[model samples]
Target chain A: MTSSKILPAMPLLAAGLVATPALAASVTITIPQVKVAEYHRPYVAGWLEPVGGGSARTVFVWYDVKKGGREPGTKWLADLRSWWRKGGNTMKLPANGVSGATRAPGSYTVPIPANLPAGQYVFKVEAARETGGRELVSVPFSVPAKGGSASGKTELGTITIR
Target chain B: MRFRTVLIAAAAASSALATPAMAHRQWLLPSTTTLAGTSEYVTVDAAVSNDLFYPDHVALDPAAVKVWAPDGSEGKVENPSKGRYRGTFDVAIDKPGTWKIGMERSMIGGTFKLNGEQWRVGGRRPPMAPGAARPSGAAPAGAAPAGAAPARAPGAPGSAGGQAGGQPMRMVASVAEIPAGATEVKLTESLSTYAIYVSADAPTKGVLTPTGKGLEFDPVTHPDALVSDEEAQFRFLVDGKPAAGVKVTLVPGGKKYREAEHAQELTTGADGMVRVKWPVAGMYWMSATTEDAKPSDKRASARRMTFGSTLEVVAP
Candidate 1:
């Protein structure tokens, strides 16, 4: 009878000793379609920002800087006004962190860091023309304690993030 | 006293005979002093200083002044007029180097001779910020900084050159206009290889000559191979509207000959620069097209489009 009672108490003790570490979360952005002109390519920038306003951190950048074998200057980066000001402007050397070849009309995937702080966050995207105006899209999501996922899409286009 | 009087008399005689000699001042004004790519129509500003004579009274003798290029070839001024005499000449300097436009004022009545300092033609403009990236193909002298990475491959954009923290040098091509039918293209980029693309009508026999600053093509047989006298048309859609611009050859293929063709179709959008290869010289049509095969109700679904004008190449 005493042994039975002790086993019951042991179960409660084990539950008290167990520790719960934060879980990992992820996000992915996709564009259904895009239109571009000849002699022109699309420039896309994606990044994460705080709930309020300030400088957001750069997540990715894509464009063709060289023609044959030449580096078009970083000065052109400003042409992506929305992202450049929020993220790209602060980068010292962008060769690695936020640069890539120009993207053809297709879908792209970006994975969010699992270690990111648990809270409310926003994903911002900006697409600019080599010759004219720009389009901007943003999606807001939340990370819960158990690493719950939230997703939203824009009428400008569709973006699925998990 | 007699010797002094004789000397004074001689001096007075010389002064009386010396009429203010009428010397003309000539200036060479290239149609464009600075060019990014192909340029045609070099305007030699043969101006006589307005202070010296009236515009209608002063005259320039075409035979008096001659233009000698670095190469053995030579050209004379055309359609010389009074006071402000302008010489409109067609030039195709295939390579980038110092081109001497020496002017010799051969006055008929006066003995005033003036020589101009050799004008340094076809020199590249200084590159922007040294911090800007350098081209890869050929490595410039020196090693990278302690923590900096090695230079990337040729054509890789944003690669740096020079010593640690040193200003990087940007390599640029200087362009020049060449007369149509002149054969022999040249290369201008030092210690670098360039791919040459002629218009469809350009001659296949055209050979590229490399020099200190750029490249040049030789033995052009096509009448339209080097000259862009006729205006070309390029059309594109901007925000779903049709737009177009006049295409001009900022830099002729003969001067600063990089194997690639750099012609700008100045349309409504960003400068329309289309890259086309000139295979065997012959007549052909060229155009750039950008169309969306699919459309949706969403604004983002609408695709932007761009198309280039048709080019007619005349083989030399």
Candidate 2:
């Protein structure tokens, strides 16, 4: 079953033009609607980390960027524990193509970092909501190759990397 | 030494079960557990109370509390104040990662002979010099209440005797004050520590490393990163090694509004690990105690250790 999915990317692998624009990958993430008395849009973070664990490359983050409080919405970014521990805490917020406002319940597509070297990576999508639960879904996919998908049961839904 | 270890372990197990009902709970409650910034500051409340986190009993001395930065260097607290019920202080988190704030106290107590009467010494009293006469007309400060003190009969030093009501036994300054040729000399030292963790950015483990003495928390999961519905593994250690069969208890805050204590009692596995599963996001007070034969001071025959920490668990 797995080999069938990889066959389509075999030609590009054989040609060794893996870094071409045609091979650029994107991830599709779904934010599930959580029912609660006080529902706040879940803060989401999408990043690709090495399969064996190393530095992480963040694809995008959806958070409260423009709150009028003395401290910005980034104050609660630590609620996304896994991402924060994996170098998210060190990031300078509002980075280009990496930071965005929180999205309502829906699905969105985000482009992966171009020029990523060939290697096994796990694309992780984590969502944490106020007055609700948190969930993380990981899709293992290699750069310059086929895609994979995984689903979360709570705050996050389907996550696909292609 | 082997037989003594077994004997102390047995005594500790029984005493651990009996302590909670009679002794007050001490904790340091941090204002916030996690943060994200170049730096942040957290204010903490320290108190001893019947209910967890409730400050109705007595205020802990703010000067006794200490702070350790993430780098394991000593940190400082600001604006310390002691009210009737509790004490408060602020810690500046100029450095990133986790920080520790709490108290560490050690005391030695023993049985001795003064004027042919067997007396006990302990608590916060200063050690008495050897060959010195017991102080006259100076009653011991902080004497245990009548029923609380371990009653001992005169000349029956080694046996754990039954209670005798009245103004509790006189506590001499130390075993050194015992007259020459005194028999059944026994000295025990105790170390007690209480702490809470706060993270300015991501959590770090340097401050969580155990000092290889007494009962300590060796968190398999980072203390500042705990959340509800997730299982956090914690290991209890004695003398830097895994301490097995110790009893650990977790009592949530807001006991004033609750009907029962709702504490979770658990025992450490052979590996000294306890998997804690929180039912909800809140502040929890954790406590564990153990007695062992390892005494750092050669003058002490046995050692007792107590560990306590206030942990905040957040919603997922």
TM-score winner among the candidates? 2
Model 2 alpha-carbon miss at residue B139, Å:
8.2
TM-score of 2: 0.70
lDDT of 2 at B82: 92
Residue B58's C-alpha lDDT in candidate 1? 27
Instruction: Provide TM-scores for the models.
Output: 0.27, 0.70
Candidate 1, lDDT over the whole model: 0.35
Docking category of candidate 2: acceptable
Candidate 2 regions exceeding 4 Å error are A1-43, A48-57, A63-73, A85-87, A90-96, A101-108, A113-162, B1-21, B116-118, B124-169, B175-183, B255-260
Off by over 4 Å in 1: A1-25, A31-39, A52-55, A65-73, A95-97, A145-156, B1-316
Q: Over the stretch B106-187, how does candidate 1's per-residue lDDT look in tens digits?
A: 0011111112111111222232344454444433322322222223332321222332235333321111211122122232
- Native A-B interface contacts kept, per candidate: 0.00, 0.65
Which whole-number lDDT from 0 to 100 does residue B20 have in model 1? 14
Position A121, candidate 2: lDDT: 93
